[model samples]
Target: MNINSWNFKKDILILQKELFDSIAPQTAENRTVANSLLLFLKYSAKCLFLKWLCQTVENLK
Candidate 1:
């Protein structure tokens, strides 16, 4: 909820972009594979976060 939290997330995104740019090949080939991998990783992280959030809320109840 804090402004700093938003800024920190933004910074993390920027760093992620930089990492992707560095790892992905410049050629057209394999680009989709790289994107798919990143997408899978993102979704996996979201699922883990949601699980954690649910556990936290239940604990607080």
Candidate 2:
């Protein structure tokens, strides 16, 4: 919830965007698999971030 942690989260989001942008799939099948993997990773990251944020909020109190 602090400025430092907010900046850190922003940096992480930038990194994640760069990472996802760097992935290039050539064939249709590869593209499908890549999309699926990307979706799964995004979902997982959201879940983890929410969990961490909840814990941080609890600790702050």
Candidate 1 structure lDDT: 0.91
Query: Can you tell me which runs of candidate 2 are displaced by over 4 Å?
Result: 1-26
Colliding pairs, model 2: none
Q: Summarize candidate 1's per-residue lDDT along 1-61 as a digit string, tens digits.
A: 8999999999999999998887766544578778999999999999999999999999999
Off by more than 4 A, model 1:
1-29
lDDT for each of the candidates?
0.91, 0.90
**Total clashing pairs for each candidate:** 0, 0
lDDT of 2 by residue, 2-58 (tens): 999999999999999887766643356698999999999999999999999999999
Instruction: Specify the highest-lDDT model's number.
Output: 1
Candidate 2 Cα deviation (angstroms), residue 50: 0.5
TM-score of 1: 0.52
